[model samples]
Target: MATQHDERAAPVPCALTPREERRSDLVDALRDSASVGLGAFPMGVAFGVLVVHSGLEWWWASTFSGVIFAGSLEFLFLGLVLAAAPLASIAVTAFAVNVRHVFYALSFPLHRVRGRLGKAYSTFALTDEAYAVTAGGAGRTFSSRRILGIQAFVHLYWAGGATAGALLGSALPAEVRGLEFAVTALFTVLAIDAVRAGRDVPTPVLALGCALAGRLALPGQMLPAALALFTACLLARYAWTRYTRTPYARTRRGGDHA
Candidate 1:
């Protein structure tokens, strides 16, 4: 009877332990962040080299990477600082450069993150690369732990690269001609990947149109003007889609009733 009962018993389900789950999350985050890190590290090294060439101490690279964490803005800030620009001018420039982040916030999955501190850090670390990775289709299903881990890894890559570059800057050639292009190259690659993944030609076309319009109309304020025009166009598209869909939906319902 005991042998028969054992044969009839259900098999136990296996589950990952908390430690194992955390390890898995870390691995996934590292894998996902590798591409971004590749770009960020070199860009960081370039920034550090520029800092030393610009006569700033090595520590300034680390400080900017850790504190500001905005790649493009950091480069601009370095020049502004060297020129002794007014604080108000710096603040305005910072706002204009980073205003696109406001749109990023609309779609970022902050609610999935657990702790208050985690959310705060996530918000602070929402770089373009991070947003691109986390807002992509594959990233939509990622856990909060994985998302945070990816950001942390990318931050480390930038910080470490900056420190290394600062140490090596004194030995390198003064010109360092092509290092400045790393960030631009990285952005181009990211934009290409985004276009391929989305397979949406019209969006890029719309963006290009807006950019041209901004350049022609508001040459002095191209970035902000382009962003504003693109945003308005997107909003208009959304409203039109909703309006068209509502009547169709109601028509379908009415047809079903008839």
Candidate 2:
């Protein structure tokens, strides 16, 4: 009788339904992405304004933001497209500009995202802001739903901002001078935040050195050259660190056994 009473009084587990889970995930995503969206939306607006000022149709802004979905690259790509840059040059430029994403992929939580379509979209949507948000310590344990929701919200913010800017560009000044600086400002903020989070001095020092070297060696092509040099240096450092750690780990284990 006592056992029966105990069982009757025990609370039942209350699991969320699928719909509720999705709704909760969306709300959490909105909250997590709010800060990033604040910056991205304005940068995107800047891109759209530039697109219209450059004499392209307003729809082109949405097309680039939605299709390319790369904030920095889209800005550069607009110039290349307007200049009628050769396909080969454009291809090379795109690779050089985005090579850093390869490193980003090494640490991004791609495994947490499920479904082939979901993974594909997530990959396509992987921006600096997304990486910064999801790769942080607090974001390490984010669920698949939350990850997808973050990316989706950010994407919407960019696309929507671009559209709004394009539509409003005509009403604004004929010459918008500082709009182009938005991308640079956004990148600087992200870099600072990353440095703060990691507290890794060597990485930024190495990057600065690479940038200086690239500027000195190839002033016209500094960006790509700097990125290549930085990547090589990072790979070498990773290899050396791993090689050195293995021996110490083995030695520690041996001493423990002895």
Candidate 3:
């Protein structure tokens, strides 16, 4: 009985405890990631089927799942690989394809991440879904370990689902069409949640603007070029804030500096 009680009372197997603040953060992250992951998993299934059709072996698809990890890029590069495109061209294309991730990386709260492996895993698992999860997670403060858990769960879910899809691709052909919209719906809910949370509208609006601008201006290279544009816009916003400032408090509202 003592041993059983001790086991039940054992440490949480993580750096951060499930305190009030941390627990809330974890819940938020889970909610955020779950939404995004639902949408992305279908893409993984499609990729799994593509893996079989492209003459690549199981490990090929699984490796792409584990390493490359980005759904759109994986789809594109798989096509490129099948077409026998030059590696250099593919590398350039992949860089441009996944470049928005660099901005995401920059925005991620790296300070909360704890140890080396935790940080590395957080970096490695930095997918759109994972980012949504981490960003939406309810924590006011975080440790590296907590973030790693959030990230790792999403990453593993993605890869595991991909692998399962690839392996069972033949058995589940009927599940293809309708099931594929999960990832889209997931992120849609997250976007709505963000808006409903009423914490910040600028984030989604800025993202939307950048996306629209990139689609209009950059087209094929939207990811990289838009990221650049977004960075510039953020800098410009900062400059405006620092110099002219905005009306927030009564002092600023009265046309005086706060």
lDDT for each residue of candidate 3 in 37-132, tens digit (9 for 90 to 100): 666666676778778766777678788988887777888888898899999999998887777887786557776887887777778778887776
Candidate that scores best on TM-score: 1
* lDDT string, candidate 1, 181-243, tens digits: 666676677678778888988888999899999999999778778988999998787667656
Better of 2 and 3 by lDDT: 2
Q: Name the TM-score of candidate 2.
A: 0.75
Candidate 1 stretches greater than 4 Å from native = 1-13, 174-201, 247-258
lDDT of 2 by residue, 1-258 (tens): 234434334333596655667789899999988878878887788888889989999999999999888887888999999999999988887887777787777778988999999999999999887897888665778889899999999999998889888989878666445655555665677678778888889999999999999999999778768877998998788667656664435445333432
User: What are the Cα lDDT values of the candidates?
Assistant: 0.82, 0.82, 0.71
Worst 10 residues of 3 by lDDT: 1-10
The TM-score-based order of candidates, best leading, equals 1, 3, 2
Model 2 clash number: 0
Which parts of model 3 have CA positions greater than 4 angstroms off?
1-32, 136-140, 196-206, 246-258
Candidate 3 global lDDT:
0.71
